[model samples]
Target: MIKLPFTLPSRPPVTRIRKCDAAQLRAPAGPRTQPMRGFEDHFVDIVDYIVRITDEIWMERAVGRIYDTYDASCTIYSSYGVVRSVEEVIAGTITTLNAFPDGEIHHLNVAWSGDEDEGFYTSHLGHSRSTHVGRSSLGPGTGRRSSIRFAADCVSRDNRIHTEWLIRDNGAQVRQLGFDLHEVARRAAEADTLEHFIVSPETRLEGQTPRKLLDLPTDTLDGWARHMFHNIWNLKRFDWLARYYCAAATVHAGGGRVAQGVRNIGALYLNIQAAMPDGVMRVEHVCHSEENDGVIVAVRWVYEGTTAPGGVLGECPAGKQVFMMGVSHMRFSGDRIVEEWMIFDELGVLVQGYRK
Candidate 1:
């Protein structure tokens, strides 16, 4: 049974539980409490607060307000190593907005784990749209447009975001930087052929990571997921998709990438292999919780490899080696996966692929 968080003053009971339909999996009602001041703790609440604080800080150009919204000791992990302080976060925000000038983030959905009293954690998936007018993360002005997707996993306590894991699509960003996607891929392939070097993460013995968060069906969904990834990415067996994914499963790769059904999912993976042959994925963090609604599994994984001939995006094999950081949030109805939302650094991959 799922119960509302007890940390905040009681919220009205969920009233009635909705039917168990994959289509009905939507954001829970409005956040438990509304943000009265700009600095109020926004991480515990749902989409509204996070989005509100984001707008106040970026759209409104109120960067200093983060000192109030984020804990003094808050730690944010991203492509760059851990951010040093709330001040750095503010600086980073300013740097990003300067490059895009009119940059705006649009959050689409949020899923959460834990509760207010202990600590509230939220997984936010969204995208950013804007014109690259000034210098941004992608480098000097290219005068290009952008529609890059990103994701955030944050935990809150006492109304301050305590920790976070942020991922963005760098591959897509590289394209927006004015380089042709195909050209980047070709460059990566040519470099790889000349160097004959590739980057990959060390694989560990399976079952090394323990499962203690929630119960699972007879199939052990958590183990099953890890196994499928091992075979598909490590063992090089894409055919395993027929068993793990439902016929109607939907695979969403944020940053303007999405595919539905097993056929499309298979094709996507195949495309990925063509681009980064011998690429391996290693799980860093895993959480699976079965609630009144259904089962949700969130896993943080990393992929590192060299670009090859069968790149997924418009890029061709450049043989440039790179590592991508990403997270996968999946929902299951009964035993099979019904839907998924995932993230990776698209721009970072391209930069590495084209590196001389």
Candidate 2:
């Protein structure tokens, strides 16, 4: 019998009694049998089973228990695709537990949808301790612990989980670990490569001159770059590339805006190129999202250059080669660029150059 956390509304109970011999009662099915439960009842049972598994048996423990019970590999998928597998999951969990033995696992909520064979489960793990702090400027602070908030779409067969698509709130977990997210995001954005960013095809001019932005082909890098700057960056020519921003395109540099524009971007790139003639800009990734008729492109970029002309940010002196990642979001119209948003690490770049 399954126990429920809450009581149901009262209903009249039938009081019936029948006399039978001890042997007959002990027999399998001499005369009568209880009605079998339906699939809905079984579905509820499965949900309860998972809840119990997560809370009572596996709470605060490593993945050993989960793996043993499910007999299946645990997998995690990011926004793009699979990031880790069950073995890695187990290793990471053990390592984490070793670092934070006093960690508490709190179940914030559980939600499920679809049938018993295919459903999604969303849960949150809170108050995880034992995070390590590194020597970076965005190191972890004291008294804070990380957490895992995740949603997993699962497929079950023969009363066991076969596969799962898990999406975790990594950003939140990182923040909980006491690392400076703004700094991390900035650095990540600056270090991104061409393969990590993307632009949508639905972006176009909202009003006049929509045709120009719409006609831009998606084939070449220059076309992409031009479309990206014109539509995405909304910054003034002289201001830091960290101002005039949007959430879609912004990176984490102390919380400011990075605008979109051609001249401004040209000046920024010129500054970088002049400082490091050997520097090469590579697109790491490009993701596209459609908004009505307009398209938004999210781009990840990496710049590799030597500080031969001295450090542009006062951190690295001349002749020092460095690599950095950054992210950008652009709105396009036809073939022309209209607006853009961007984010990256300004302080870290300067610090790196100076320290190097």
Best by lDDT: 1
In terms of TM-score, the best-performing candidate is 1
Candidate 2 regions with alpha-carbon error over 4 angstroms: 1-44, 56-62, 69-74, 79-81, 117-143, 146-153, 165-177, 182-356
User: Could you tell me the lDDT of residue 235 within candidate 2?
Assistant: 18
Write the residue-wise lDDT of candidate 1 on 268-313 in tens digits: 7777666667577776655543435555666777777766754664
For residues 192-308, could you state the per-residue lDDT of candidate 2 as single tens digits? Answer: 331321212222346734333435654544355544443333211334333322322322121233323534455555554555555545554444433343444445555555555
- Model 1 earns a TM-score of 0.68
Residue 70's lDDT in candidate 1: 90
What root-mean-square deviation over C-alphas does model 1 reach? 8.1
Residue 325 Cα positional deviation in candidate 1, in Å, after optimal superposition: 0.9
| Lowest lDDT 10-residue stretch of candidate 2 | 11-20
lDDT of 2: 0.40
For every candidate, C-alpha RMSD to the true structure in Å? 8.1, 17.5
Write down the lDDT of every candidate, Cα atoms only: 0.63, 0.40
